[model samples]
Target: MLKISEDKRDTIIAKLKQDIDAANAYYEETIEPAVMERYAIFHADKDYYRKMFPRLSKRCEITSTDVQDTIESTMPVLMKTFFGSTDVVTIQGADGTDEDSDRAEKMQELINYELQQNKFFMKFYRWAKDALITNLGIIKVDWDREYKEVQKTITMDAEAYAQYRPQAEAMGIKVNAAETNPAGGINVTYTAQELAKNRPRVMNLMASEFRFSLDATRLEDADFVAHRKIVSIDYLRMQGESGMYQNVEEVAQKAVAPHYTTLDTQNNEYIDEQPNRTDTGRQKVELYECYVNLNMSDDPDGRLTPMIVTVSNGVILRCEENTYERNPFFVLSPRVEPHHIWPETGFTDLIAQVQHSKTAIIRQMIYNIAQGNDSKMAIDTAALVDINDVLNNAQFIRVKGNVSEALQPLPAAQLQSWTFNMLEYLDTVKENRTGITKYNQGLDSNSLNKTATGISIITQQSNQRLELIARIFAETGLTELFRFLIKLNQLFINEELVIRLTNGPMKIDPSDLDGSFDLIVNAGMGAGAKQTNLQNLQMVRELSTQLAEVGLSGPQQWYNLAKRIIEEVGFKNVDDFLIDPSQMAAQMPQQGEQETAGEDSKTTIRSAITDAPWQVQMQFWQKLGFDVTPQMFTEQVAQKVLSSAADAQAKADASRGDVMHDRLQQANLARPRGGGRMAGTTSNAGAQAGGSTGALEPASQYNGTMAGNAAGSTTAGVSSY
Candidate 1:
């Protein structure tokens, strides 16, 4: 139990309230309005934005859902474009550790594995994409072990030990002070001189160690935020201010600190709002879990002070300096603000004007329907008992003569036409503001102004806007989350673990890894187009094959290029679709050919040796009747055999390249062709030089025939795939 003085208690509570008051002030004024607006839009609650409706008309569902529809329709599209297409997270070592690049890549794989196993990554993306207007994202670490079980000890020296009396035969470290040595250690003592002389010799110590264990865990946001939080530009700063402790090292390894659960019990500040529960306007705070980090401290290093304190409300429940092992939680402050530069507002802010216009149109349409036409009406004000009843119902009232013509059911054509025009105008405003439109959303555009060039420009703009938001989430939320993962792994990983990273298998010890990694997120194409990547890959592949025939690149280079294309296409494991070079080498027929060539060369050499007089010849003399010596015969046979093998392999590769290039070209041919689109231009440079000589064309567009393609052949025939 902590011994807290009353005065200190009052001070801490007062300071907490002061901070809360400041946060609340910001929340009530700046954050609340935008947050509330976003909330209403999400819930489709017409009443929330009903105040902004036209004064002459009541709020209508059709007008209120305008903003909601725009937001909802755009959310899935943005998510599909970003997360749907981009399925890779690449972590590369930027601090010049390419020697261990594979290790870092494996760590990335491990993270992805760990992420999918526990983290709400996709779920969070789905939730955060639309809501990105207010906050970029809320990333939390769901680790295998948020905290470890640790034993702590309390040790007292000889003087304190001798003076201590045993209250219990055996005991824990926690007991009342009145009980002498309540930790229950037997007192041991000796004369000062005798102790000094023999203490080392006897290996006897008077010091007593009282040990106890505690459960440590990471903190949730509720552990710290007792009052409402303001998630503005200052929110992270406010969180930084909340950290307070005694002497525990700020980045301490094993120092004793209070676990969030312990602090929560002491403070009793938790109010659980079930996250999965369906409700509107629920207050949810994230990134405010300071106590989780406070739970971690350096390993009781003598340099830093240890703390054991708990509180309830503003009052201190307990504050002690008892020795204990602390939890190991580390969180990084986000490097980028998630609010995406619009700190004062969000997605709803951009839609507010359009929403008002939509509401006015809806209200006018309502009036048009109520009045039965778009013409002037002159009904005597006193002719009806109730004007509202006359408009809404078929209630008849004593009117000045016949009131039927006065209530003209004017032309429906004008009413319907104008309402639709207003709707179209409002939709255009929404499309411009949000960068979401019928074209992008897969809805056909009815506007006469849409052209291929114009639609193309709008498509690019929409993609860029979504790309910006996705990147904001990536840079701030995902990056910070990765930092936290690296920190935690560094602190807690004890041994190497083998993980089959998406590319290949690798072994990694997270603790051994440095945290200087550059995160490369393949956010994929913001436009739902995969052709550009495929086309570029095909071109590169062709270039690589051509380079190999010219001896510029080795076989390994082409193999690597192929692997890259497979991965770029979003294949998790490339070996499935692509052949492994090692496997191909193992299956190759080069071994048998070398063996056969060696035997033939040996036969020729033996024949040359035996051809000379029934004796082992020291040297072969190539003169008179024998044109070749034994060595010459061997060289000739070896060169001929190896050349055959090399020539065969080259021909096989050339044929394969020709087939693949043709297939790719055909895929292009299958698509609707247009100018400025990447086109395959034929170059006979390689073909004419090395065309169809049963060897790879080193410079031809068609990688066939080192002797040049057959004269007058057009493009390589496309396979009817």
Candidate 2:
């Protein structure tokens, strides 16, 4: 750390303070008003309605949920699209060497593992939701090192203690107590100082807590950016002890000086509805972690270098040059407008006007209906005995004078059909604006009456809108987040990392990830598009099989197709379904042996097919694109059938059924009774008829016997039929 003179330090702090105050002022004056309005729309705040339509206390004040509905529905789609698989992020090696590929795989695993450890799903949910509601969502990623201590008590001999003390003390462990035991060994109690491992930290900052230069379009181009947080005084002291800060006593003293809570600013006051903290005897202070480019006038080049400074209550806590060489914040917006830091429109923004119009219309409609149902009467008070009698729903009311003259009912205005028609029109307008509709949401009543082709087209167009948002997020913020994490891991996490994935454990060394790697985002398209892709892949799979017979496609092509299909279907363990082509090729016999074995294999295969059940044989031939029967099983057809089956079997293994009986018993216990009968179960009528039901024919496949009880419920157990 460079030791700075008091005057120079003051000059730097003043410059940062000036920049932060100006940025905050600009945000409070301009951006926050719109953000607050959007939040009110999202929550459907009654005050927001009151502000819109003033002094309508007794009238209908119902607010529409258009904003909430749009945001909520879109969030699940975006989340599932990004995180549908284990490999949310992938890296491709630049050189394409085996070593580089392996390193890239390990690096990708390490990045994903770090994200999992940080509970990134929930963080992303919040971040994306914020971006949808407000125009921008921000996240900070940095390498954090904090102390972790554990206390341990152990019994050991004096010689063992002597051997351990030096090593333990070198690691900063403190010996609390040591005493001789009755059995001639020492019982020692000590607080062990664990290794200070550097790990990546991800924090989702509210739009209010972050500030940047007003003219900057991106974080990297900004001259100043700061994150404001209210931290405890003790946290500052800890930083001093960790040698991360200078002038601890002065900084703590300055922080203790009374100041407004960091979140109490006008920009952040309505950011969230949270209770004020009661006195907890721990002093709290506002801390600004600012990243800025400071020009040291003494330098001859006069270039501005990126630096990080921590300040609180006009006191500098820590200052150092930025070693990471880039900004740590990643921003997300559903749509990016040209020449703007935040998008001009958000999901809620698009629907805000619709919600307002709908709410007003609904309130008017209900008010009109209410008035019509309880009509006001023009009663002659002088002729009526009591006014309260008219208000009550009484069968007959006594009037002092003629009944017809004293109590004439006032005619209420009848609501026109256009009132309801207008509401529907507004809903249609909303659907058009947001690309969310009752049809796509599966809520339209008339959707079933429409042709399947029409419905599919509508769904496809709607999905295209959502897919654009997903792609924008994937190509921008998500990519930046992974890139930032990769750089952090390379810089701070020098040692090997051992992470356990779903498949198995992997050991990754960050140093091995030295070469360039391109990021591969695994964002999924919408469900309809995915289904289309799956269909295409299936068609390709069939084509690959056919080509395999002619030597155009082989086991490698088949394995690749199977791998893609399995991944698209959301399966991670490809090995469970398909054998690797390399392994299968290695297992093949030599040319001489294969020639002899081919004849023997064909004879055995034909015998097996002949003995198989007629249903199985028919289905097998049909799957091969052949409509065949027992009469069609000639020698010429058998040769073609055997050749196709051999190729298919070589590429992939058919999965065997693995069921646990204990789990089945548990499921049976949980299953409710007195419902539909299980498959292969005989009914009471069949039991009384005294013959096997056709349902029992399939029991031969599982080698199970079904016996009917007195209650006519069949019990299935494993036995030869």
Candidate 3:
């Protein structure tokens, strides 16, 4: 807590007030009219009717909420694109784009783990987006200690005091300095209880917190102050950054709401319970605290440029002048007016003008018709009790003479055809200016029925207007958010953060993370991405298939592209929504084995089996120890039984012939040693007719089929010799 003199505090308040007053003046003069009109559009009641058509206000109180509804309709689209349900922010480390590096990988995991624990995107992205669209979007990077000493009330007797006081003091517990107690020992707060075995080991953990601020309530635009270089600004009359921050806090204290927290769930029946510090009507609110950032400082690089002041209950709770090594706040706009500090245009701004015109014309027409419908009458005053009661009731005139009254009709008023034409023109203007229409807004009517494709094409073409705004926001706001997260990592995280990744778990070592990476915004990505992505993936899918067919891509590469395609189609990551290619490793034949076994031979054998009946294929495969089923075998499976049997019998005969020939050769060699003369070669005729066992079976055996079916049958002439 920094001290400020009474005189100085008043001076600081005066200075802050002066700036606020001046800013408010600018707001009221230039921007307030449009904002008030927007409010009228939102309310769409008497004020609106008066604003649009003063004369017709009493007659027709119809005010359309089209603009407000259209604006709201854009929100979900923006959210889906901005913080896509899949991957929104990518972690780029100081070590360049190589995500495989140790530090880079760890940093990515740390960010992921933090996001999972905090749900910053899930909870706050949409709120911030709303702020961006109408007002100013902001983000703050916070780093606070996760661990705290337990605060428990403990009573001590003299004996317990003697034992506990020494131990408590050793553990850094502060004791109350009361003089003496009427009781033997004093009751005091002991904060040294080390949560231990009584608590399960898993329970011993610290949960980090995430919070987002969508405060644009009292905010006067920052770009106005910054770009205008609003000079002659008075400071809080402090010496340094810290002192100035303290003064800013004083200002915020006066502005923040008293008993700010509502504590809606503190007493809810469905909500789970937690230890809470509660007051009577409004509880002690740690979560509902508010913040103000004065980002008008001249020095862009110096500390306290965007000074932070936090307050609750009309008192300054925290004030600090620091940086996230970069600006902590991010500003976004859906559309910006040219040469304007703050964009005064929105999706429905122009629609109001048209709506007002249409309302005035319709109301005037109704008024004219009503006046004409009330036919003028020349009734004698004596005939009626009162002139005011002339048309009050259907009266029977007492005059017997035929009333020479003719039902004269006023000249029929015809609305010009161009009135509708002008209304159509106005409608066209609204569609042109805002890119919003009944068709795009999903308003159902017989007159306007556009196909979704036609509507989508028109919508996409119209998005060109918003795309530039989004690009500008991405460049400034998104980059700042990345910087904020990096600084938090550097300041708060000390333990290794485990983040599950596609390859494996990456341990994000905060100390090793060097936050230096470019923030790249893909124009083809985000809100409009879903449509373009589908088209692109369709094309890429074809190209990928062609590449695979041409042997230019491997299975792994194909798999990676497939995962991306899955995501491009707005599905979750491949790991969650798509089947993993690696999961089929067990089912696939190993590379070496497949090659060594000769695929050509296997293909021939498989073809033969495939051409056979399902039953026969199953029986043949069963003999070969293959688990084949009738359902599993396709028509491609052929003559399995006949092929396997013939091949087996042929193999058996070849083996027997080789064995007999070898034995006969050995006998011939032995006979020669016993002094038998070597007969040159047996006459071809002798072996042809009745030959020795070792002699060839002429050419007949070699030419014809040697073996019969493998059911132990052989051709009669077929000889093993």
Candidate 4:
């Protein structure tokens, strides 16, 4: 433990108290007065001071009295009060503390420093206010309420007090001696922490109106700047090159020939032109050329200049120079009218003219035929010539008169062969026509009829025997005849020859070559038969086995065959064919011996009818008879046998007192009634007969008796089993 003597402790405590008191007094007397001065200045300027003093004195409620109290409340107010305002200040203390004397001396020093600081702040505030008023038009003394609040926040501390003590003493103010205290003396530190925690209101009061002065000026002289002028080459060269030309003769020689002139040079020369008219035709032309030059710059070699040249007739022509002595230049040749090398004529017009001329009379003949006219005679005459020459240059066949000789008329024989060959090709066209129409138009009964009729007509026409006017006219004879019909159809029926011929319907049956008939007969019934009848006819011919055979042959054989068959077959009435008892009896065998034979045959038949019911066989048998009902004869007999046998067994079992057997037999005979139970009464007699009360014996006993009866029947009689 550390201890101090009572005297030393007392001295230390007294020194600390004195120092605190001095610090407080300094702030009250010095720092507070200086801040008040600034506050007064800030309050005077309203507009210019608002940014710094955001709040006015009225809003902040700051006053000189409030400021003084604030300073007195804070111990460090002394340091901020005096030294805070001046550039520098010093505080003086007594060497030794003799209680009253030391305290009085220190207090005097602090008071002196405080007074000096007050004077310093007053001077600073006055100077600042004057500066702002002079330069920025601001009256610092009239600042608003916020400025007054700022004035209240000024504070000071021990170091500041000590620093200003010497000046304070010189100003007749007291300072305090430095000392330490056993209990911590009044704190004189102004740390940001203490300011933030304990003096926020005061600090905010000052901050709200805090301001500083700024000075600015613009430089008069700047380094980067310029001014100048540009000269023109045209202006410099306006005096002409003569003054600058040393070798005039050489330049003149060079100018004697044409030289190329660029657009810019030409424009310049054009701009420098003068107008004049007192000149020869050549001179006048030169003036015109000069006029052109005045509107354009001269070419480098004067290539665009038009010169006047006189001809023998005194005609003047403008020509561009072609010399290249000075510099190469482009010269355009004189314009001339173009002459036609050949005339134009249309092929159609030429052909028309040829058709009208007598020398080409054949052309007209061909044109008439091509237009679907009846030109058979002319075609016949042309067809007699060489085929290549006739066809290639054929008068009756050429569509256009201008057709070349290579397509002349074909010879009659060759033409006949070609026509025949074309018929073969027409077959393909016929096939294609059917296929195309079938695909596009769809197959229907009507279309099929039309097709068959068309095919028949075409086939007949193709195979027809024609009477030729002459052998040499065969080509024209056939073609002209066919063409006439085609043209007639085209004119009257409005159908094309190619379509009428090639698009003819498909042949229904190629084998029936002689079945040609008019399609319009019987309202087109013949057309329907063109397909169906031909098909039937074909079947009769090709499939003879399938037909009724007849030995007749050649033309009309079918008709004869039909007649003979009809005559041989006598007519019979329906009743004559009907089954009678006599016929039925004849169909059956005689009784007795016949019956034996029938029985033998029945055995074989029965074997064949195995697994078939008697009723089924009897139905078939009665079908052979005219008046028998299988139901009355067969089904009734079967029902009677079944009923009688069932009844007899029932009576026998009852009489035997075999109640179990009786019940069993009843069960066997009884059909199912309802609810899945057999329709038979339980025999109470069985219980009475000393049998098991609730049960019946098996059917084996009855089965044995029936078997025994069946064996006895076989031995007793020979009847149909």
**TM-score: the better of candidates 3 and 4:** 3
Q: Work out how many backbone clashes candidate 3 has.
A: 12
lDDT of 3: 0.48
lDDT of 1 by residue, 1-721 (tens): 4434566556545654554445445445554455555656555455654665545435244555666676667667555554442443467787756556755766666666655555444555544643443432222332343323233334565456545534322332332233235566433431111111100000110001000111112222212222112122233233234443231222122222222222123224553324332422232322121121122233444253344333323333335452313322212111233422224456666777677677677777787675664455456566555666556656455565567743544354346777788788878887877777777776774644677656666566666665666565555545555655655565556666665555566777655465567777775555444545677789988888788788998766777777767755666466676776766787667887886687567556545543454223323332222222244233333433443554565566567788765665555334431222111112223222222111111223333531242353322211000
lDDT of each: 0.46, 0.73, 0.48, 0.29
1-721: candidate 4 lDDT, tens digit per residue: 1133445334433533343345334434543344333333323323323443344422332221221222122212212222231112221223333343433333323223323433634433332222221111011110011111111122345566556546656764333343434553332322121111110010011211111111101111111101111112222122124232122222222222121122213224553232232321111111010001110122445433222111111111122221211111111101111231101121112222221222122222334344444222233333243544444655554333334432433323212345445444543443332221221223334556567557555533332211110111122211222222222222222211111111232221112111111111011121112344445555665554434355435434444333323322322222233333444565665555676676557555544542356567555544544222343234334433554666787787777788766685867556442233211112234322322111222235424433554533211000112
Q: Determine which window of 10 residues in candidate 2 has minimal summed lDDT.
A: 712-721
Error of 1 at 486 (Å): 1.8
TM-score of 2: 0.73
**Global Cα lDDT for candidate 1:** 0.46
Off by over 4 Å in 2: 55-58, 86-89, 146-192, 256-281, 391-396, 400-402, 522-524, 550-552, 572-576, 579-721
What's model 4's TM-score?
0.11
Query: Model 4 lDDT vs. the true structure?
Result: 0.29
TM-score winner among the candidates? 2
- Best-to-worst order by lDDT is 2, 3, 1, 4
TM-score of predicted structure 3: 0.57
Q: Can you give the TM-score per candidate against the true fold? A: 0.52, 0.73, 0.57, 0.11
Q: Which segments of candidate 1 are over 4 A away from where they belong?
A: 1-17, 54-61, 81-89, 95-98, 142-312, 315-342, 373-419, 445-458, 498-507, 510-515, 521-525, 554-556, 567-570, 580-721
Candidate 1 contains a number of clashing pairs equal to 27
Inter-residue clash pairs, candidate 2: none
**Clashes per candidate (backbone, < 3 Å):** 27, 0, 12, 81
lDDT of 3 by residue, 1-721 (tens): 4354555334434544444446545554555455445555654556758865676877766654555655665566656666663544555554455453556546545665565556555434543444433444443434533334566766667677778778867876876542236766667665554422110000100001112221233123331121111111122213124242233434423432222111223223433333232422221223112223443334556443343333322234344443433323344555555444445676445567766677787777676666667646666554444555445644643432344432223454666678778877876886677655554455647425667677667767766544555566666556556556655676666555556666567665656775565444565654564777777777877888889888987777778777877776766656775555666665466765776467446445555654566688568656754433343343112222323444565566567898765665455334421112111112223323322111223334433423332232222111122
Better candidate number, 2 or 4, judged by TM-score = 2
